[model samples]
Target: MIEIKNLCHSLGGKLILNDINLTLPEGSIMGLVGINGAGKTTLLRLISGVYSADEGEIFCDGLPIGDEKARERLFFLPDDPYFTGHTTGKALFELYRVFYPDIDRKVFLEYMSEFKLDEKKPIRNFSKGMRRQLYIALALSVKPKYLLLDEAFDGLDPLARLSFKRAINQAAEEYGTTVIISSHSLRELEDFCDSYALIDKMTIASSGDIAERVNRYCKFQLAFFEDFSEQIFFGLPVISLEKTGRFARIVLEGKEDDMKKALEKLSPAIVEQMPMDFEEMFIREVEGRGYKV
Candidate 1:
């Protein structure tokens, strides 16, 4: 498990994150999401010990993250991982083996083959997606207890995305590896992550099971026989509403059954409840905070 308490950090005399507290259980995959410059990377760095916190403590399985033993159990994959011009994928594996002595050579080779990467070739010759595949192979070989990934799906084709997701799921199921993945790809995250944390305004705006969080908001498309004003949903826990002539699309926050009944009372010619996906939930969340999404 990972626990962070009273976490605060600053850079160049400007506060980036403050009073942040989070707990992640073992063997679960979590999606870390936020807009640009929301300190998502900073928080991940703090957890991985790349940057020391100005205040508060971070623990991995009861040991401080600064502890070498704790650090050994954690692997952090930054958005832009570093590789020199002459660094070959095979050479990278050897280097990682020095630090992670338990790194599985066979597993690494297997994944490399699956990804169709030439480990003997210089990493600089590989495209962005290929490099990412190489590093993911390395990560799987390391088999750390906790894996931190930033922009995990940035440069992958659809096939590679499938392979990546498959590998991550396999790691979690077989090795009990806990993962925190930061990404702008909410749809993909929604498909795999069991839970999510939303970082906004310098802190965690929301975090919970993906299904439960999405269930809180209900969406509906309604068509009326005659013109009607938006005020019809003024007191119905409306999160967002769009009206065009006699057609309207609305999202309400309440029990689904209750919201549906309330809307039914409005007597529309047609009322259809639409499924709300993660992307829609995120848009509504930020929009509720006065963002013009």
Candidate 2:
């Protein structure tokens, strides 16, 4: 398990994150999400020990994150992983082996083959997606207990994205690896992550099971025989409302039955509840904070 308590950090005299706390159990996948510069990457860097916190502490499996033993159990994959122009895929594996002595050559080769990458080819010759594939193979081969990936799905086509998801899922299931991935692709994250943390205004605005969080918001489409002003929904817990003529679509925050009952009071000819996905939930969340989304 990973524990972050009262974590605070700053750069260039400006505070980036403040008083953040989070707990991630073993073998769980979490999506780290936020608007640009919301400190998502900064938080991940702190947890991975690339940058020490200015306050508080971080722990991994009861060991302080600054400890060598704790660091050995985690792998941090940045959005732009470093590789020299002359480095080959096989050479990259060797480089990782220097730090991770137990790195599995067989696993590396297997994943490389699966990803259709040439081990002997210089990394400079590979495309962005291919380099990402190579590094993912290395990550799996390292077999770290904690995996941190930033912008994990960037530069990948649909097919590559599927392959990457499959590899990550297999690793988590077989090795009980704890995974935290940061990405702008909320739709993909929705399908892949079991839980999520939303970072906003230099802190975690919300964090929990994705399904439960999404379930809290109910969406409905209504039609009325006569035109009605939008103020008719004044008392209801409306997150967003779009009205045109006698038809309106709305999202409300509450139990499904309760929200339906409240909307029924407005006497609409049609009151149809609709499914709310994670992307919609995220949009509503930020919008609630006065963001024009």
- TM-score of every candidate: 0.99, 0.98
lDDT of 2 by residue, 82-119 (tens): 88899999898888889999999999999999999999
lDDT of 1 by residue, 1-293 (tens): 99999999999999999888999999989999999999999999999999999999999999999999999999999999999999999899999999999999999999999999999999999999999999999999999999999999999999999999999999999999999999999999998899999999888989999999999999999999999988878778999998999999999998889998999999999999999999999999999989998
- lDDT (CA) for every model shown? 0.95, 0.94
Give the worst 10-residue stretch by lDDT in candidate 2: 90-99
User: Residue 97's C-alpha lDDT in candidate 1?
Assistant: 92
RMSD of 2: 1.0
In candidate 2, which residue ranges exceed 4 Å CA deviation? none
- Model 1 has an lDDT value of 0.95
